[model samples]
Target: MRHRRIGRSGLLVSEISYGNRFAHRESANCARAALEAGITTFHTAAAWGHGAAEEALAEGLREARRDDIVLCTGVFWLEHPGASQFGLGRKHLMSSLHGSLRRLGTDHVDVFQLWRFDHRTPLEETFLALSDVVREGKVRYVGTAEWTAEQLLRADALANELRVPLLCNHAHYSMLWRAPESQVMPAAARAGIGHFASMPLAQGILTGKYRQQRIPPGSRADNDERGRSAVRPFLDASLLERVDLLRGIAEEAGLTMAQLAIAWALHHEGVASAVVGASRPAQVAENARASGVELGIDVLTQIDQLLGGFVQSDPRLTFTPTQYDDL
Candidate 1:
């Protein structure tokens, strides 16, 4: 697998990383397959399966060398209702990291990310806590996910002030969602922070299995209420019809629709990695192969023309739980 450093930091990750958020009862199998496929980075969060995901990932990586893999996890939106259990406050961050380290059977994690921007907590406190974790040897590099472009720039500035290298912004960017391209990527580019495009597959919609427009049994569209809701907004008649057209482009490129989608996200210059969550081992391997596939300029442009009006590009139009009213 091809690997790249996160932003200006020395922490390297595979072009195709594995995340266990939606991995199933066979998560161990998927994780093992990732390691076998040379996937060094694995992502989990305190909110996934209430920590079952972390333990399952550790079980899968039990036989691999510790230093050979990068364990990247985040904290936010916990199951608990306590006031102190959900935000990026120092107390919650420390508690969450300690719990994650213990669950993963490690003393330190390679990258500790804030799953969301906690508007209630001061950014100053959040950055300070993140810096403290690096000093305490619990976290190597600090990052965030699903944050607005303005929040990311302010975060980069604070990290610079605190001298803590903010490694990357793990945002929702894909063939269907181009909001990050509007301002997030440019802001990160100016701040020297890398970008990890989460949800590159659009919750399996880009896999082309849905091209027939039939909801397959046991698939995410059938079983996942949240997943269904997540993709519901984007599955319009025009976009769905356009996906059928996209299949031809994928065929011409000698790639699957899923592969084409992932490669499309990676085609962006600032994207250090594209994080893919798979429910099965074969999905893991299939996504792993998308690492080195290159699309030519003509194919890329053709794809742009076909799916042009369907994508979400404006960051202002981007919806997230937290907004920068302070901006």
Candidate 2:
């Protein structure tokens, strides 16, 4: 696996990270498969499967006995309901970090990210709490996920002021979701913060399996309500035809449709990793090989032109209008 440094920090992660957000129940097996497939990084969350994901990941890593790998987890998703239960407040952050550590069966995680930007809490409070954990030997690096360009800048500055530089800004970047490129990716690149691309396959639509208006049995579009919702937006016949055309491109590039999608997401200097979920070992192996695959400028341009209108680019759509305005 090829390694990329997270932002300007010494922390390095495999270009392709195995994320267990969707397959938390099978994470132990998935983690083992990931390590075998040369994936050194694992992305999980505090509330994934209500903490089952972290524990399962720990089980797999323990069985593998590899502490030299990067383990990344996040805080948010309102793990519980309480006045002080959520957000980036010190109380929640400190307690959340301890809970994550205990569940992962480790003293610390390599990257402890603010999974959501908490407008309710001061950015200073968030960074201050993050800095304390770094000093307490609990978290090595701090990052953000799905934050806006403005929010990224504000938090990055606050983190620097606290002497705990932010490492990466992970966001939803895929064949269909290009909104981050409007401002988020450039901002992170300029700030020397790495960008982690989540959902690089556009929730499986770019994999070509959803082509010809046929949703395969047991696919995300079939089983998961949330997954179905994510995949529903691209179900138009014209868009499905455009997605099907990617099969020829993938063949010409000597890549699978999924691999082509992943490579495209990683085809930037600022993007450090593509976080993907897999259900089986074979799927993990296939996704791992796309880490270092390079695409030419011609291929990129063709892709951009093929899926023109279906792609999302508006920065305001990053979240709700009211929420984005507040950010």
TM-score of each: 0.94, 0.94
**Backbone clash tally for model 2?**
0
RMSD list, candidates in order: 2.7, 2.6
> Where does the lowest 10-residue lDDT sum fall in candidate 2?
318-327
lDDT of 1 at 151: 91
Pairing residues by index, what is the TM-score of model 2?
0.94
lDDT (Cα, 0-100) at 20 in candidate 2: 83
- In model 1, the number of clashes is 0
* Superposition error at 120 for model 2 (Å): 1.2
Candidate 2: lDDT of 110? 85
Model 2 residue pairs with clashes: none
Error of 2 at 21 (Å): 1.1
Candidate 2: which stretches are off by over 4 Å?
22-25, 80-84, 319-327
Clashing pairs in 1: none
User: In order, how many clashes per candidate?
Assistant: 0, 0
